[model samples]
Target: MRLRGVLLPAAVLSLTMLAALPLPSCIPQSTPPQPPPPAQPPPPLEVTNPILSGDFADPSVLRVGEDYWAAATSSEWAPHFPLLHSKDLLHWEVVGPIFQTAPTWSEGNYWAPELAQDKGRYFVFYTARQKGGPLCVAVATAAQPSGPYTDHGPLVCQELGSIDGALIRDENDTLYLVWKEDGNSRSLPTPIWAQPLSEDGTRLIGAPTQILMNDSPWEGQLVEGPHLIKRNGWFYMFYAGSACCGRDCNYAVGVARSRKLLGGWEKNPLNPIMKSNESWKCPGHGSVVTDTQGRDYFLYHAYRATDFVYVGRQGLLDEIQWAEDGWPTINGRRGPGGKVLAKPAAFSEDFTSSSLATGWVWPNGRQPTTSVEAGLLSLSPPADRAADPIGAVFARSTNAGNYTAETVLDVSGLPAGMAAGLSAFGDPENALGVYVRSGKVEVWHRERNTHEVLTSLDAPTSADGKLRLRMTAKDGQTYRFAVSPEDTTWTEVGPELSGAYLPPWDRGVRVALTAGGVAGASARFDSLRITPN
Candidate 1:
């Protein structure tokens, strides 16, 4: 949908201007203009649920002074770990990533990053599976929250698998790292463990102690994504359990408390504190943070049950209050919804700047040839990388389930086999897109090794060789494609495409501009407009 300002007709404009001119003696003055309607208290800030509307999961947040910083799992989508910054808990902007490139030792499956600051240095502890190896927790250090973080090496590794690492500082200044011992494959219950860390926050100091394991009936087959916070002299560990992906995903967050940092823990009778409700499904993997005013909140992820599961898990936020009995409750025991919330302090991004907008990221990092200038983003397909899952793409998460994304592409320069257009990408195999190639525009969908062409139409001829493409996603389950020679009018190109085939393993669908083929092909895209419907 296009946004335009209302305009006045020529005759109406003339009369209105004349009426305002010399209303002097002609129109009797109204009785002194009555005090401006008491200023109507500027409509309450309507913050929306899922403050962050896209596939950002396993959020770990920390409040530093007045600023809040967060990091989340990128899995196989690179740029390593994603970092977000906000002045308030309600709104966030992407501040690039923690690692500019994947570590040499790890190939993919980077998940669950926890950000922490010790002494004065910032550290990020995360899980990465090395090529042909097991999943392990690793640490990286940077002077700033969003970093060119330097890998400090593995912090926790086991023969089976170890993932989801969280760091907490105790009252006595002791630092401890908590992580999960993955056991889903062996049919054994997954367990949480803790180990002390050195002063520099680089390595573990002693042997690990097992904290808790999957014991509740609702926990399904695993317990992971452990986050620890201290309240009222007690250590509270919040974790996610049950199946984390797919149509029947039963993921939920449960809490366990302990008097001692390492042992003597008891699960709350309430058990799963957060779970799926009518609107959002699989709500779990949460991290808690307190605002500047000391109000507490739970930041987590959940899927829109009505949308295709491949839409991924979007970021959600809910207010939490401590009960008289010292237990925490989320949104008065209600789940996520479309209800209006109070807006956080205002934040904005300038895409015209040389730096990429804080809301945009390149999945699996960016190719050296990818560059952004002014408002135009250009990408050159890498040579011999046709088989890469991520290919050459620059994407940003869909902040809402229903939205319209439009872009103007100059694909004239693309080689014969090269293609460029807008796409809803989950991975190389699972994507729905409308691409321009060889003087033709085609709509296609891919699932794993199968690629199907839904339709193709002749590319509209333009003097400048620019094509305008628009994609509308409804409830995140279906997509429609349209094209235009110019931005003003559009023609539907293909039938509505179903996204039902998208799988949860592909994570959430990233709306992106993609350029790829056999090497030497490049595409320039500009005027990208993403609007929520």
Candidate 2:
């Protein structure tokens, strides 16, 4: 059937096929080009050791929701107990203090504060010296973490000296308080003791039981700073051992576990889980916490292994992990240094809003005559003549081992015997002050109640009646003092002073703007700056 041999044009054939096909509306189409996925943010930078760079010792931290709150020993420094707040474990800021004033019954030496919350009320368990009495554990209560806490007197220690009070609540909600016996006084073995606590955490309910003592060679003369935690149905007790102060401070942290809360305690085979290394000295007195992501962390204090031992113990952060055997171990296991850790989120603080930064503290209490105006800090001598110079000193903790502090002093209209300037103060008997006295600039050093003039120079004759004073703390070992007339050219005023004389028992040295003399003595400090070396 070569039947229809009729030739059709190519255009006609194409038109016929198109007309027979379905319409364009019925045809499927390719998807339009899509935008690229949004770019992800970079990870936060890692932080180094000593996350908190100042004298934050015996750290006890608590996690509440997204916030982490910490309390540290502020021995003889008032605002008695310092409270720090952080969103991440890396960064922290001072959020006032646990007590604006020391307890009336307690004279000085406020140490290790452990903070906890129950039924929405905050409680602080701390150690303080009673007026002319032995050091003992005490309790305080507040409505919030950053507190104006009210002291509830001392915990029952049965006439025994006690310190380093730590609190723990069991799964059954039973409360207990653990403390260290002050054995340093009697030259006996320091012991860890535990007692039941009342529901409100204000009173001791039962007889205290001694759980552990300084038995190991590593535990030198003391086994103190007890902290309790539970994991995998076991009670873990962490305690610090050895001397905690001075050049001989060989402190370390050890662990003990018990199936029962108050009995059958077993020390870890690998004792002294955290100890001093080449970079950090006397690493101990630590607290543990878990983050929102279920990561474990430990916070402790350590002194830099430099010639300058006067910087005191600064706060350190390290991550911890658990083994299959159920014991916890720090990630690096050595000590906090060299390793870069992930930083916590940033925090905001207004250091200039107040006359003193929130971090500033006085040795005993703030003087009534001290005032802050328009960024100027004014210090006036106490009206009481018998009061110690330590009380009148207005200072801030040195945040780093090596740093420089500078201030402009307006010493106009000063009386003959009055002096006002910068001071590296440890106590009434141990300090170095560079001041303008009797129309001359002099550097004085006080050692063991004897004050000696190191050097003296003519005061810079500035028409504005102001003197620029600067102190450089180098390597935490030596201090250099200088004076400037125009705040431009500085002249070395005194020989380099040895900072090693500053003992750790004095809790290192505080840089202060001091005014000392009879009544009506006042000094104005302006443009104070502290920079890390």
List, in order, the clash count of every candidate structure.
3, 2
Q: Alpha carbon lDDT of residue 452, candidate 2? A: 80
Query: What tens-digit string does per-residue lDDT give for candidate 1 at 97-210?
Result: 787688988877788888877777888888888668888999998887766788988887786788988888765768988899888857887988888999888889988899
After superposition, the stretches of candidate 1 with alpha carbons farther than 4 Å from their true spots are 1-47, 144-148, 169-173, 337-353, 363-368, 372-376, 386-391
Positional deviation of residue 315's Cα in model 1 after best superposition, in angstroms: 2.1
lDDT of 2 by residue, 303-378 (tens): 8776335777888887776788877776446766545323212212223456456877676755436776765666
Q: Which ten residues in a row have the lowest lDDT in candidate 2?
A: 341-350
CA lDDT scores, all candidates in order? 0.77, 0.77
As a whole number from 0 to 100, the lDDT of residue 252 in candidate 2 is: 86
Write down the TM-score of every candidate.
Answer: 0.83, 0.86
Q: List the residue pairs that clash in candidate 1.
A: 78-364, 79-365, 312-508
